[model samples]
Target: MDVRAAACRVEAPASRPLDGTVVRASGDSVAVRVAASRLRALGCAIRTGGAPLPPDAPAGLLRVERAPWISGGHALPECRIGWSGPVAVPMAGERDVQAACGIMHVHGRATGGPRALRVDYASVCAGVLAAQAVTAGMLALLRGGTAVRAATSVAQAAALALTQYVAVATTDPGSGSSRPEPGAERTPPFRSAGGVRFEIETFRAESWLRFWTGLGAERSAIAAGWPPFQQRFATATCTLPPGLQAVAAAWDYPAVRRAAQAAGVGIVAVSDAGTPLPPPPASPWRLRPLPTAQATEEAPAPDGRPRTGDGPLAGIRVVESANRVQGPLSGHVLGLLGADVVRLEPPGGDPMRGVPPMAGEVSARFLALNRGKGAVEADLKSRAGRETALRLAASSDVFLQNWAPGRAARFALDAADLVAVQPRLVYAYAGGWAEVLPAPQPMGTDYLVQAHTGVAALLSPPGRPPAPTLMTITDVLGALISAEGVVAGLLGAGRTGAGVRVETALADAGRLLRDTHEVGDRTADATAPVVSDLAAMAADPAYAALFETDGAAVYSRAPWTFTRPSDHRREEP
Candidate 1:
């Protein structure tokens, strides 16, 4: 869920993302051509191989076209959005239009049609978009207005020679490309909830009862037959919150739940997100970033080369069945920390292989999130792919995949299927549609989810037109979140001899993150500059009067714990 888009929304100073509906294609390329008015309103810009490309047909481009809207009184081969400020792509032409698009080029090797090449083409489109968004901030090269855009792709955009891109990969099952209203706070949140719970299926949640398995059954025999079964605590200790104990002692489930909800607390009654989860009064566990030791890096080695560390995860092994950014990148991060992450790609070298690339030896599109990891190609659709994945899972402590919803099950990568074979294994995922595990055919990605979840709306604040950020913000965030579950699940399985399966839907993370009021669609943006932005603006005015054209001076007392360098820019990093 893209929660950021939920907080604030204002009329577009310009309009864009003009209902660029995608249609069933014949083969390779899809086109995007919008009206000059709508395109200009959105402040939309298209760049190919680096410089600006005309919407009609940029030179050196393999394919280019526009989309048509029979309902909105427009028609074309593909669709394009006009320009607008940051956050949210306002649609035009049709009141509701949803299209999934991609590009295809005629290289004389055409073996399929548009729908057939959809996955491959879509991957390329997403890769390019992700790449551009990574380095989208160069827009500030415009003299004075500076926007700090940060993420993994700056290197890739240059490689691809493209500037910006967007995709509407998915829509709610019942939704029909309905654009957000003018005054609505950012986009509507695809997932929204507060005080949800996740209860582990163990003695910890056994109410007042305790499970003393085997030699540890200190109190189990006596408690097993106790008249008050829930209160039986023989071997294992039972812990509960002070508030919950009083309520439970009085047999008041409703009261306890009410109090917990009022306190903004999550209760886990069952492991399922849809179940009536009520946490058994245990204090929340410490939440933190899974420890990471730099996997690879440039350092002051004797030869000034990259270095590797034999950190805590030196021998840990993982298999990645993830595509694009969300899932595979997590493997990259883990690989950086000394984990042996084996990324499994389906035949065509992972959809990202052809997305785009940066200059130099490496392809830009494939470079952003895969600095450290091994690649293994397999076809789940073949006799070999399924066997390879299963074999890999058997030996892996963790398996991660983000192939939409239903796709995983079709490939037999779902948590239940994998856990049955590898009980102590951890399964991590990043996806949408609010399902922990679903069929994979669902069209889902950062763009559409950002729209549906309202995250795009949040990047831009009040009185500002929403902008679809170039960053796969939610994907990155979801990676981190999923990593936590993976680590914890692994730890639990190790400690309890149980490889607990863990699931994290994009929608679930979105709702959990939306606990604050500043989310997209939930709150109107305050339309004020942040403190840092304000401070930078203020500091600039003062600095201009004191600095010379060829000289620089930063006024400040030396830190008590440090000494100033001879030259500000001379310090070695």
Candidate 2:
């Protein structure tokens, strides 16, 4: 699921809680922890022991003088809310309190399940706030008038709690209404999930606009005013490869576009969305589209010729945790195009660093890709390795990793965790899903996608064996598209303040590339055996996979012989 989109529904698996980032206890008396600073900020006083309490509650205390009994499908007596006291619980009495405490469904408890209650962040934050209240207030009253100030503080805290609790209860899951609990140590989602905590500094609306205006004006002046601030931005973009960007593009373009522009750079950074749209005509400056976090200079510069650089992307830094072919070479390409690319390898070094042709100097894969790059080794699964990855992710503008799904998460290198630390970071992923989504083939790969999507099939035939052209040209084509998406996302990030998540599967890319022909029409000519009557008749027989005469060649098929060969081949199967 998308990271940002998760706001409306922080979806997670039934087996795990907190989206696999954290877990929760399944016991009845779930333990909760609240922060002291946050409670004070909410205007509540510490009244008693920092007891573990549930979320979605308000001020007040009642001594439990009786044993528990069943009522309203529950085993606890109830207390319904009555008078609105400044320092009283919203739903008082033991009965109602017990019910609300357990079944309130405060944050759309149905969004998830037992896992929800377990790692459920609500119980934690709300519990913490309540703990502070009990301690501050109860302590003050029992400690005698010596702690009157604490009682007043508790009242103040209760007021804040009322507003916040009401906000939580009434606010729709989809609406991003209230900000995080004010003065929170970290954002709510982060606090709930216990991931990275980003320090935030607020900006007044007018002041924020002024900063952008000043920055835009400065950039416009720097460019010598050829393209106005708006004009340059209007065309600025980043290109992404087949990766995460593909998934992101499935969203509303306007929202994505707006999100990009807000990122402040000319491009947006997202996982590569494999689909490539035709680009706008070239101007003095070119815009790389998102999928690359913050658009990078894929093409050297606008100098009409590639120049050795000290320019923006000239020495920019990128840390790649990629492996084998696509992922590693992607970073290599960035370095060749002039960004500083650092390759993270396993203890044995990148597999590519030894892909045959070893001259003890240049490995085959490394020769073609890893030029002008450096390497380091780490076991991403270990604590030390993850720490290294974190350090690199924090410092780099782009993080490239090509592992199977769920692999990165185990290492905590998933999009959510990384973006929280650095929003400008562009993440790239390349994988294939034959089972998850429908595809022409049951197994997805460059060769299979091309073959099943008609690229290879078009070039091969029934009577003849399937064969792909040398050099994996089809894969390269998809890779190029993937690379472009990466750049586009980065550009979007440069323009917008938010980062994006993108994905491109081999199966999806191959099908997209083959969409040029009319689909679902039997008569439409789609290269080779699929061609229409006239085109098929005129096509080269042997060359086009049609039955041919005995000559050293007329490539066009003899329809008569072709029928027999095609049938015979099918019969043999």
Candidate 3:
């Protein structure tokens, strides 16, 4: 993907000037390169140096660095490196960090392999996050706040990527029963009689039953498979009975597809690695300015005083109505940045709140992302609920939602509607496909998006059927992209005094991941065996430090650390 082209396409034309130099220390890590490339695309003059910048450098200068571990206090013992088949080589400490964070465990469980080992993923995510932090710091300086320095580690990034897994593992110790033994082959990407490999997605039990029934699957087998199949998103493991696989294998690809279409199921043929992927979106997220009568105000220059307390978005307010991982995790990241987030839920609250593996009555999965956020109960289908939503948006700096494409417009609470009342708000929508794909869209869930965008093929082992890792890859990454969009929109709003609409989709996130990483045949050294016990690793002192538990619920610590000049003391002369 052309990083510069994507950046140029979404450039904040109406925002205040972002003129400055981004000084990057020389580093070979993919994370460092990604961050520098993105910063340069944002119009920051890039300067590479082997040494740290001089203390007397220009006030506009910002430094970016990538490290194996940001804590810099304790050194973790190097563990055995597992075989990284057909994936990018692991950088220094990459595999170790990922192992400690339980990423490999989740991947291995989902793929039915010893361990789906790779490091490129965490590094890429860290790079995007670093760029986000730099942008926020820049925004703070433009708002007359003190200059700030931000730092992140590959470990922290991996931890953030596995936040949901940590939540589930900590809350329910028995969840490990679903993990497949090493060398076990799981079913999902079932092979047809015609030698075609494909994946099917069905949301409701009826759809699952109908699809299997049309394919001549046994009633008992279909009924037994539904629980595990539906729970894969949360458990990261799906073990379907052999009868279901046999039923699929009996039919040819076209016949299987016909059955799926007749049953209202989503199906996609597994792509090959050599197949060319569709061009990625111009940008992962779209930002558009909203017309408002409010007059723009010139941004105040930096005052040189150190920014104190909280994060860059200390005083910002975000109102979010999101479900599942993508939307809630976006709001969670915003909260970590010190924004006050108020979650708008249905009158009885989000049903996800009752999902199993409870952490003191609240769902551990829900608590992972919505821990510190405030909640508001409103029946969005009702007029009073819409009024309440509008009232909240009128006073908030950002309004985020991930409802179906037309649900917001139907409720009269879309970007146009909210901006009419609060002209300076930043409205963000995190959807499944956006407007990129044709209509009659498949369900906009993570695994389906993976199959549609060829991500399933990219991660599959050589000669294996294409299968999406049940790790919620696109959901987590989409959330990160959405948060980045919200921050960018906020910056644009600050500069122009007008509302902005930020839109991103799961497909876009999948495309970004697919286009950025190049998959090849070079495999890593397989000297050490794969680690299997995630719970044991989580309890280890070195890994335990990365997470904190609250009432049996565990969550990752903040990924980035911010420091200002005031954090240090002046020497007495």
TM-score of each: 0.38, 0.36, 0.84
Error of 1 at 339 (Å): 1.3
Worst 10 residues of 1 by lDDT: 100-109
lDDT of 1 by residue, 1-573 (tens): 111121012111101221232221111122121122112222233322333433422111211122221112111212112111111222111110111111111100111221111111122222223222211211111111122222211111111111111111110111111232233222111111232221111122333233212112224332432321222111011222223222233423344444334433222221221222122111011211122211111111122113333422345577888865567655654554345788888776765554422223333334445545678899987768888888888777678887755677788767667765565566666555444223331245444444434443443445643333323445554554455445444433332334455555544433333322221122222122212111132134422221111111111110001111223121111
Cα lDDT tens digits for candidate 2, 1-573: 222222213222111111111111111211122222222222223233333422322332211111111011111111111111222334332222222222122222212211011111222222332323222222212112111111111212112212212222222223211122222211110110122111101113333233234323343322322221212111111111222222233444444334334533222111112323233213101222233233221212111223334212443466777653455545554553345678888888865554433424444234444545777788888999888887777766667766766788888888877876665666666555423243331323344344444444333334533332212323333343334334444433432434544454554444433432222222222121211121122232322332222221111111111001111111100
Compare the candidates by lDDT and give the number of the best one: 3
| lDDT at 476, model 2 | 36
Give candidate 3's root-mean-square deviation (CA, Å).
8.2
Model 3 C-alpha lDDT per residue in residues 1-573, reported as the tens digit of each score: 322222223324532223333344345455656666655644455566554423322111235332111122111110011122111322244454455456777887765544544326676677667777877765554344554566666667777888778788877777845456444348788889999888888878999999999988889989889998999888888888888888899999999999999998988777765565556544446676875525344322223223334888877788999998999999999999878889999988999999988999899889988999999999999999999898888778889999977899899998889988787788999998876467777678898788777788877767766788888888988898889888877766665556788888888777766756663212554333344665555565655545778867778877777667454322111
> Each candidate: what lDDT?
0.33, 0.33, 0.69
Find the 10 residues in a row with the least total lDDT in model 3.
73-82
Residue-level error in angstroms, candidate 2, position 133: 59
